[model samples]
Target: MPNGRDLGQDRGGDGTAASMIVTTKPPPANSPGKQKTVLLVDDQAFVRQIMWKALSATHAYKVLQAADGMAAINLMRDGGIKLEHAAGTDLMEAAAGAKIDCIVSDINMEPMNGLEFVKTIRVGMASVHRGTPVIMLTAHADKHFLSTAFALDVSGFLVKPVSGTVLVEKIERAIATPVALKSASDYATLIVPDVDTPDLYASVDAENEQSKTVRATDMAEQFSQQRPRFVAISELKVGDRLSEDLLTTEGVLVVPKGTRIAPALISALKDLSEIVKLMDRVSVVNV
Candidate 1:
């Protein structure tokens, strides 16, 4: 994979090729209705063109194109898509002025992969960029890639060779979905922590004081009467009631408390154990 600097050279000096492909004409000022904007990033110009045409055909979107992850970030930071004649401006100022509804990006590109770009936007960029919905386009559907995408809070995922119609539907869905902005600490908890994980408890403790208070109150209320007994996860049996919610290391809720153990639930928990170890011990109330 070529780095951003190398791809910049490949696209004619200084990365002007990607910038030039963006529509130079600004959307009509004071137009009756504003069109939702989408940023499309792919290394291949042809792919970008196809997506641009497909999205534009809806007459519902104003499209922007980027050749790679680096170019995408630059465009996003610069505010609205740069026109051939427009004056340069800061991204924060532009983002404040105009909102971008969605981003559609390919996973593989030189200099900055889609994953890196998404991470930058989600956790490394300004608040304006952090919560924008993203739909990842990729040919690969392996668990590793999918898990990574989900961990970073990607709004949607589409396998490649998708039709323009499908693409448009995905874009709309992504736009309509609520954005759950995540912090770096949240990401770490979900992606890295496991059983024997003192790290998980530390993260929970480190959350904002208000959040800590709320969680403490909730836990206390739920476990007040029937305190849970910790047992090895492998020893769980049917008819046992969960004492608290089971969350993956990523903090995704797996099973809510009070759920009676069942074979299917056990099977699902076993699968989760392979990836997250949920927790070393199962907390259950005697039934």
Candidate 2:
């Protein structure tokens, strides 16, 4: 119920007042045994604290907290600040420079909402985590909200007051699922409308029964519209056409849409994927 400064009474384990920024150092960067890092973004300190406690309990994740979407973006851009234990034990020698594996964010927040943050990541081009999985947490589960969230490439959605166990499971699933398997249309289908709608075609036997038919030809025409198929660089073939623009994290355009894939281009894309985290899956249309 409380938003922002109104929840100042809440304090973390370090006796620090819950403010706009509250972060704990995770394992050091590049540690062979480092845990996966998850950015938990929410305006309410108490809610962040609850999720943090749940995540930390498992010792499986290094949790980072941000008050809102803007704060989360700033943290991502700046890498992350390292905080030492009260006894002067440095958990991180430098800033936690590890890439955020996933994000669990609340839909309602000030300055920039959760959906705005995701859109920024997708189009920002300069962001290394542009393709990172995002799990949205919302108090409202209306169809409009679900549709809008999926359009922005959200990986999963959880209503408020979510249990700790369920939150962890969702994070695991989000991270495990490849970017190629995430589809806006497929996710949107999860939101079923209240009105009773008949299947594509069915026989009606009501008092005022009126049977309607859908033309298979029209459906075939719609399906004929070439759709972009996402494939990993290793899976790319010579005849595939670029269905989406490909850009590096530095905002450099590597390949424009509509370019036909070639053997040389496939080799170059493979090299680029190895050099940066940006290009795991490329959208292409088969010739």
Candidate 3:
């Protein structure tokens, strides 16, 4: 049986070995025999073009463009791009078995957003579409959005106005790393616990009614010790560690938890504050 590389080989018209013109065309630059595919989804034409051009310049990807999440989903379900001449055969089979390696999609779009699109593929789509790495592109940095994206098992998140080099780096990292899968139900449980669930306060509150007063006193002390201090954004100095993830009002992560402050980071935060005030204060661990 002919393998993927052996397909479309030059043959002899005369049906004789002597008449055969044996030649092998070189593979596309920077790729072996097959190029890894990337589905670029965005509602805007210019954004898609920019991503397409950037990936194309690397010569390591076969870029596919989609205007919306629905279109992108259809393309994924059908597998590889169908050629005009290959009729009556599955594109996946005809292509010698190639599938998309990564997906980069904009967060906001009409009909379906990026989060919805990812959920559909991960939960509702065929097994072939499941577990595929997805990188979300967005301008919003709201914590709620970040938490939702993380809960959905999105591979990576890139803030918008990203450069080509940064995009490529994110793509590479996403492809190389494997993310643990989680169901939407599991995510919901973690992000929003049931108010009626007894276990919600079990750790803090005593099970017996007799210990309620002691429990309250102990809880107050612990809370004071554990609670993070709110410091003025300007008062923040280098080397201070964040007690929790610093986020914009829109919920975008500014700096993640446990990050040691540096001069460059401080400067960036200052610049970011000019656009959006990071609440009037930031929470940091006392050093």
Top-lDDT structure, candidate number: 1
How close to the true structure is residue 241 of candidate 3, measured as C-alpha lDDT? Answer: 64
lDDT tens digits, residue span 28-65, model 1: 55545667878787887777767766766555776666
**Clashing pairs for predicted structure model 2, backbone only:** none
Candidate 2: segments with Cα more than 4 A from true spot: 1-33, 85-88, 92-96, 141-143, 181-287
Question: Could you tell which candidate, 1 or 3, scores higher by lDDT?
Answer: 1
Tens digit of lDDT per residue, candidate 2, span 8-92?
A: 2334476432333333434344545657878888877778887877776665776667777776776666653443332345354
Model 3 regions lying over 4 Å from their true place: 1-34, 80-97, 124-127, 141-144, 184-287
lDDT of 3 at 58: 69
- Judging by TM-score against the true structure, name the best candidate: 1
Report every candidate's CA lDDT.
0.60, 0.57, 0.56
Residue-pair clash count for candidate 2: 0
- What's the lDDT of the predicted structure labeled candidate 3? 0.56
Model 2 is weakest, by summed lDDT over 10 consecutive residues, at 194-203
Model 3: residue 7 alpha-carbon error in angstroms: 27
Order by TM-score, highest first = 1, 2, 3
Give the Å shift of residue 69 in candidate 3.
Answer: 1.1
